[model samples]
Target: MNSKKMVLIGLVLTAFFSSLAVFELIPGLLMAFLLLSVGIAVTYYFALSRMRLESLAGISILLKAAKEIGKESKAPEISRQLGLWAQRLVKSEAVLVWWQGEWAFGDEEFTAWPGLETAREWVKNNNEVLVLNQNGGEIFSHPWPSNINSLLGLPLMVAGEAAGILFLLNESKRGYFVPQDSEALEVICQQAAAALNKARDYQEVEYFYKEILFSMLNALDSRFPGFTGHSQRVARVAVLLGSKLGLDEEELRILEYAALLHDAGKVFFLQEGLPGEAGELEEMDKELSVLPMEEHPPLGAQILPDEGVFARICQGILYHHERYDGSGYPEGLSRTDIPLAARIIAVADLYDALTRLAPEEERLEPEFAIKEMKKTMGMLLDPLVVIVLEEVERELDEIT
Candidate 1:
């Protein structure tokens, strides 16, 4: 670039000297002209260099934004990342991500831009790259906060429709938002739109699946008189225990699903040839010599979808019946061999059973249930999980 600039400057100097000779200007005036030409050439070169450098910086920022935003699988996080990236890339004072009707703000120092309804409404209808930079000694004609002298809006388009809009305000330390910033924002929005839309779809689908799971669990629980709200109470207690054990969010989610579906095996208790109905499965199990209660774990695990995320949930359900001392059914997984979720659910299951769902004569208060559970530690329950259950006694009592 410097070499090209030198070549261009040489051509310009050659042209200028030839003009000077043809015009036969006085020496003093000629010297002044030469100085002016040199200064102009130098300023032009520096300006071009700065523009080139800024262009490169914008490209690098866009690449980073696309890579980071594409890596995210959640809509809220995707919008947040895009907002923060835009704020950093363009040095904006504030960024607002309007994701599907939800709004998220990214700020440098938490300055609120008031009275943005007109601008937002206009941008929503226009659905284009709108820029409001009135730096040429002109006041903003739009109804905007005096503090916000400049603004940029980019629509997040998915499948030819707008899924969201991004708004940036007060760029580059209160300076006008340049054209380069707008171009960079357009590229970033193009990259993020599809990802954000897909994340929204996945989120909705996941929520729907959970609703179905809860509905099914409710139906299963309703089949037995004593099992009313049984799965939900177990889930609450399991989550408390899982939290006490320091399980992360994802771990706690799997634990909760497993607890809710722990009794899913009992869904088969209503199958053909079984004798008893409405929570009398134990009597039915003995009378018909049919499939026993211990066999429901595998059946329940089999009923769930085979997705990889649900793998731990299935394992938890499959092994919830297993004992820590190798005395339980099916695989008889012992000690740490039982999945952590299974162990936690095992503790929750017994605790809820003894306190709330058990026969009236067998039922104990929540505190007493914990005390009874203590005796089974390391034999029927994971010792660590049982200890954590004791820690959650205060909360458990309220729920039970």
Candidate 2:
């Protein structure tokens, strides 16, 4: 028998012997002690079994919730899922706040509650989960409104750094939290922190990949004089158009990558004559010119897949030079058959090329470049994209 059962049996035997001494009934005391011991043992056995089952049920709930959270990538959805579970389990209001350099309550969905800003700052500064008993009858002073009696603030740590806090509130009952409650929250927080850190590490790895790709592009830019700033300019214009088009986060990423590395194949075209040498064309330049421009599209498509954002970007790089009519190279896709990202990059790239100072030609003025872009609409470029580019050019001109 467990310690609890043993203690109950000892108490019953003691009571029975004492009663026998007072009433002088020896046989009755023996029967009474035997029956009391049997009853106490049975009761304690059932109570212990029930306690073990309840503990298992609590653990199962946490495990199920953690599994569901692991599959989600969106922040708002994760918060909502956790909040719903908290509401069901604790009968309390739960809010999952996010940190974007600074903490903001989970996408403005729970902004009506007061004192969240202070609470967020506290979590950010301390990097430790806090359990506050808000009811005046309890230990800690209430930081929220009178209706909110208890608070549990869990820091969502990512990669050993705090990312945000998960806040749960109990409005009706105060001082109900025990040491066991805090321990459960700590377990949940640790699981959440691990998942969040994995996600953050994935994002950081992607950023590093993009940085490496851009560094390669920058090196290629250095190989050609008068083109030192060309890729950077194109990237700026592409990002501008991407924002104006209301591209989603994923699409914006693809567009940025394409713009930064569209001229990747130009690395293969670097001539030995150098940028401004004024010498005869080398055999390498002649060979490069004849090496099939059609291959550039496929070559870029091959190199970009390792960077997770490049599936869409490869299409942009391969088809950025394709004309709106069927007169373009490679696939010869025309009109809307061309991807929108490719179409946007085409306009931005051509505009930058036209305005840049070449070795033999004067730099085209912004007005002239806009006019020329308009002239080529529906033939060399997508007409609608040209309209957007014109607007972008005007805005850029005003800023300058």
Candidate 3:
């Protein structure tokens, strides 16, 4: 029968016997029997009530603990929360122990606890929870402190593999943990395992994304001559200039992207039209050279997606060759009418080209290249951009 019903039946029987003794002539013996029975029933009732209350309290503690654990996204936070909850539930100290390829607790650096290595080895060997008695006196039982007689350990399992163990200790020698206590702890461990796995998966996905982006950049480099290291260099220079110009993070990112892919449209341009071939151009070749040069900027714009940062980069690509005096092709936008990214790239592209070798001749001496750049400052280039280039040139010389 249910405990409540059994308690009620005992109380009723006690009352009936008491009434019988009181009404009968044979008084003393029956009266003593009735008093003993009534005392036993009352004591049993109180004990059962306390047990029920403790069970309910245990359930409430676990529910709150599980809810808090569910809300946490970090492993250290989870461990701290588990420690706090165990302290509150059992009125004692607790520790959360985890093992991967190595053992650890929270985000703290790993240190070997005296018995932990042994515990971990045992779990790995047997794949089960280990509970020990007090006094370190038990063989075939997990170890517990003499001061804290009760100890409970629950295995954290994922896919039937032991991931870690949860150890709860009572400072006062409460009786050994009941089956219900172990059951509640097991549920908490299950939730923790799931959370850890999710974090691991997220980290893996992030690494994969970075790998993919770098590989794509490498592929683009392989297809274009003299373009292998160009994008990274441009990005670095653009970011430097963007910082000097007091651009915000978002603006800096756009400038960097534009610089990296400024010649992306050239991917579609004829290979023979590269700057290296400029010296080899025959009189008849001028027509072909001019055609590809005129088409690249617009074609680059068409190659990328039509919105956001990519679109902005495309706009920059389309106009990087445009001149300040309306002499440039595709569109003759002059001076401030051109986008800032295109203006910045115009200076960078020219500097790189002038300082590098081409098919016809060796790269120009720095002094001669600077003089040529100064000549075109207000007509072919933005006057401010020319000033910035002069400063950058000085810095490069100092570093060299």
Which of the numbered candidates is closest to the native, going by highest TM-score?
Answer: 1
Residue-level lDDT of model 3, residues 198-246, one tens digit each, is 4454444345336543554565566544445655665665566566667
Q: Least lDDT summed over 10 consecutive residues: which range in candidate 1?
A: 282-291
Which one wins by lDDT: 1 or 3? 1
- Which residue pairs overlap in candidate 1's backbone? none
Model 1 per-residue lDDT tens digits across residues 94-182: 78887676575555332244435445656677776767765423423545555667878788887676668888888445688766677
RMSD of each: 11.4, 15.2, 16.3
Error of 1 at 392 (Å): 2.1
TM-score of 1: 0.55
Tell me model 1's lDDT, rounded to 2 decimals.
0.72
lDDT of 2 by residue, 262-289 (tens): 7776654443332332222222121112
Off by over 4 Å in 1: 1-74, 85-90, 93-211, 273-275, 281-292
Candidate 2 global TM-score: 0.50
* Number of clashing pairs per prediction, in order: 0, 0, 1
Q: How do the candidates rank by lDDT, highest first?
A: 1, 2, 3
Pick the winner on TM-score between candidates 2 and 3. Answer: 2
